[model samples]
Target: MWWSKSKVSSISSPLPCLCLLWLIVPACEAQQQDLGALLTAKCNSWNTKTTLSFPGDGSFANVTERWTVFAPPMYSAAISPATEEDVVKTVKLAAKYNISFLATGAGHGYGTTLGKLQNGLDIDLSQFKSISVNQSAGTVTVGGGVRMRDVIDAVFKAGFEIQTGSCSCPGFVGATIGAGVGRWSGIFGLIIDALVSVRLVTADGRIVQVSKTSNPDLFWAIRGAGANFGIITSATYRLHKIVAGANGGGQVMNADILVPANMSAAYFNALQSFSGKMPANLAAVSIVRYDADAGAAGILANWDYMGSEADGRRAMAPILALNPPVVSISTVPWNKLFATAGFGIDPVLCENNVIRDLYSANVRNLSASTMQAAFNKMGTFYSDHPEARGSVLELETFPNQAATSVPDGETAYPWRDALGNMIFLFSWDASTNSATSTAATKLGRQLRDDFVKTSGYPDLSVYVSYAHGDEKIEQIYGRNKLPRLAALKKSWDPRNVFAYNNALPTKYP
Candidate 1:
């Protein structure tokens, strides 16, 4: 899927002008002279047309014409900084003119918060991406914009491998700050769990280094929170040794049989059963999708096992015992197993319909019938929404001996007692379906709310990165940590320079 120079022109571009008037023009004269002037000045300063725009012509027209994309308004000049000085210069310029700025690496976030500044400078840090390991210190220093795959390649080359997300395109900085869950959770832990220090540029254009020793409050808050605190330039994380290519794979169980007629009731029961007999080494989740080519027929259940081939087989014996599988793929190496999960150089962008806290109460306390009932409703919803692809359920179990041992209030992330986390991912086309996309998003929210109520864990936490933007801030961070987070926001970004994100508003002095 790699593009060549000749093939580039043949491909149809989406939008040419990119709704410049709506975005570039500020809402008021004051904003115009401030934010607007900053943008124009920055674009002129860059003096390079290629740095000003994206490869695609896709713009506001695409969105108005039935694309539910939430691209930032004026992204004309995308500065690719290769060094920390570049970032400092950009930040200083932005601060001088009172113009909001956002930093993005791969821009793979589903939440619109990352790239939705009305009229601001976009600092694309892809060029700064580099990964180096210090064998003696057992620490790795990674550029903010380094893609997960690049880190993998670099760490692997250095004779060590760090746990990264499944998608290779997601960059390290944004992912780590926003809850870095991955395939190695059962043994290693989330990416944030391994972080030691970060280099950042604060709202007022002040560059600072933070860890347990310096600005510890900001350090703890930044790990699980989005980039509301500051712009991360680089990070130093602990490293681990990995088995190069451990044979990995799993089987798929039929959802119809597992989920009974009473959807919610059935889901709860299954949750209890699975929780009681949960295997530490095995990470599994159920998915629901209707085969459009097969005329809306029900197809459910998918699993991923990251152990050796024989070990994967032994771990999935219970799932296999559920019934014969419709599709089963296994291989050596964890990355190879995930490659089958669809992480190739595909042309289209993926929109995942995710519900973070599907199970509120401890699964062991839930009933099988309750779990079955939930699944039934989910199936019915899928049948109704034909465009909605199947849900990819994800479950990650971090080792108790690892970072989960950190107190709930210790970090900005408050969810500490859980055995693991789960996500119900549904993907759909980004083109020619504005109404369908909006409806599907609404449905996803409804599914999340219903599950929350059924599970009886009103306090269940949602990962800030995966959370819907419209959701209340307290829902993601929990009430216990809201005041502390707000104070940190006030201390670092008193003027709210990064307020455009899922920001914890400074309600107090």
Candidate 2:
């Protein structure tokens, strides 16, 4: 039985509440034991591997730690399945018990959807790591558990290249399923666009293959809103020959510039101008944040050019003319770009247990005045709340030719026309006062609203990957696409078992 709010409200004193919780502990333990026994028995019958971890088990404890520790989901138990068959069994058993379950890849997602899983099962997919490349077909097949770094290294060794996320730690499948945006997106396209096919376990426990020719609707839905459908066991993606650069190597020029707060207006103007005519080989990111050590706010701009140093310099000439302080500019091989892009720190080693609130906006056209106002508000927020000094506003205006080239109706991803993705990331130590975190979250939302208002954007179209869980379904997957997605959800997952991660409703609003 679930604990209802009314039952908790009857306990007037703290002492009674503690006693009540202790009294209910044994019942919860029994439930966990029964669940574990059911999973074990089902796995044995299915002839699959399963490691059932009860609540408080070290494995269970570790599985709950997400990228952001704000409000992680609670699971009665966790299971690590070794093969696709094991995944099928796990899903089937969960459906039999009428239990909701979530498939965790890298645990890098930050949405609040994970927090809603109460007494649910965690289908950990880390054991499914596999990588295979077919040079003749110019394609690569990777397991669901593979990370960006894993695929990148494997493909690089095979004399091919594929688009991947900047952060090498995120699960490759998780990123691509949401229309993965990466450094090479401008030249090649989103990781999803290169998808040849996917081997997934549907909600009904069937191992199915989805592609353009086979199960086309499922294929289109998985390209953008995959997490809502089922668990992907493996996926095949197209790869390209390595580009030629200096000395017969694939070299990319990377530039990092720091702009003073006073130059925010000028910097944005320059960025707007550069983004409007962005070259296919170039990807740019701009960040506005408070540097506590410097006791002032500033802007950082990073440019990635997939070409020789001379071509990169020529492309960046307009922005360079603005004369911001150059932090660094170097040409390195394709694989080393992740390190230079500031993703050098491993996700596990970085600071954990923090409150994070993220919001996104698609910028079709940049308004300098609107951006300047947002920056000024950020300055005020940083000044007033030192605890949130680490917060940042990121504007990514990469060359999205390959992404935009695809017709809007072809996939569930609706932000193809957007030239820039604006992310307002606010964070603070979880140990900080709750009020501080609350204030920071409010400020982030306010900033996003102000940006939309100032920029004259018609609607609130947020990137589903970066959403904070408060956005409407239509906003994430455009208004026109929601009805179809809802219909698909009703057909594929009638019971709504995969109702995590900004879930789509079976019935459209």
Candidate 3:
């Protein structure tokens, strides 16, 4: 959902700040100076590896830049705490000073609600970059600041595998907290399923160990709503043996097929065939974008199968029958999956700070008709506004058996049976006109509503990580998981200090 096809220009250099005691806050300088001085002194004397940066400081931008530039949080200053105790000190200081703060690692948080943090102190977790792989224990422990690439490399080096998002930039713990999903999900389950435990720093700066056995309620909340409770100092996840990789990493059958615009129905129909019976190790993602050469939009299906080439070809026969114009297949290490995945070659697809109005929905079935309608809508949208051609609609397919096997009430993350993650993103350059922006939001919501109507569920089941920040509380967190999450919020974060990530209220009335 975060990747793109257009090339983004390099970000401008960061501004420099030179304040003796903490960075200066542009407004209300008098009051802020006192608070900033106190914060700086307290953090400096902690005897921990902590660093501070102001608005214009060189390191400030590194800690604050995010994947999307739209409506990002504004910070007056930032603190990069080294140890878990240092994290606690940072949080306590922010609370004691009544300064709003947000903890970020990799800063890929895309929710618009994050913009709510104004002139807050940023608790940057980049310093907590530690990875420990226990080959004998079949688990890997990582610092909260570690990104997916860090975990992927460490775990793979140990000849073990862990579920992770496709991209390597997002915080490993941050993504899991949002109920992570990717190509590996069909085999093991959502990233949340692999979670073993986490060292969490609560709203009141209390460092606690949460697991199914200790503080189990908090553990349940962190599985999905961890961001709402506190900062994750560190996390440990269950590891699995590599399936097809013998030479260092596992290999898989990967295919990148480009279906003509007219073949939308056919491709979706083939996808529907595998909905309930999708192979546990087979996964596919159909990205809809403007295929300029065709003078219209089309689907780029990136397929991955953890089986032999013959069996992979057999499994993809239904789709291959479409005679797509551009088809490329290969068998390589799992890390190579994205090397040729849809628009993977474009360096911009993974770059940060591109403006995006992304929306996502969890559909219980691969209804072909509904899928076609949405596909057609996106096709027309691209044609109407050439400047917005970067826009795309994605349909991700993964087996739900592994996830559902755990049963409901197992964790705060709902939608164990969701069959697809339909992500619609409206991407455009900064020069786009306001008309195009309005239409993007207008059509984006319309398409999201349409998908929900035929989603095969009575109400919307939203993937919080991919949410547009406008969905109802019940929609983000399943209705069944709300009350419990609300109580947990009240118990752990009653002050609602961490309310930036599609926040759950202190109380659900």
Per-residue CA lDDT of candidate 1, range 1-509, in tens? Answer: 22222233343433332333234345422242333233333233443432333224343222112112343334433455656766777777666555566677666555555446654556777666777799888889988878776676566556665667645666788889876765555556678888899989888778899998998998998978747888888899998765445322222111112322324243334445555344544554443434455443342443445556466556656555544324454453443333444222112223222222222122212334444544555566666666555443333333223445566666777654444454545555545367655655665666555545544456445676666566666767778788888888888888888866677888632
Model 1 misplacement above 4 A: 1-77, 114-116, 243-272, 297-302, 327-329, 342-371, 389-403, 419-438
Runs with alpha carbons beyond 4 Å of true place in candidate 2: 1-33, 42-49, 245-249, 343-353, 454-457
Question: How close is every model to the real structure, measured as TM-score?
Answer: 0.76, 0.89, 0.91
Model 3 agreement with the true structure over 1-509: per-residue lDDT tens digits: 11011111121223332333324343424343344454554223654567767765677788788888877888777778877878887788667666788999888887889999887778888988999999889999989889887787778778877777766778899999988977767778899999999999988989999999999999888887878998998999999877554322476788889898878898889888887888877888888888888889888888888766677888878888878888988886665565656647424556898888888889888888888998888878887889999888878887777788887788998877888889888888888779988998998889888889888888877888888899998988888788889988988888889988888976666
Cα RMSD (angstroms) for every candidate in the order listed: 8.1, 6.9, 6.6
Question: Which pairs of residues collide in model 2?
Answer: none
For model 3, the stretches where C-alpha displacement exceeds 4 angstroms are: 1-35, 46-49, 243-249, 343-346
Name the better of 1 and 3 by lDDT. Answer: 3
Alpha carbon RMSD to native, model 3: 6.6
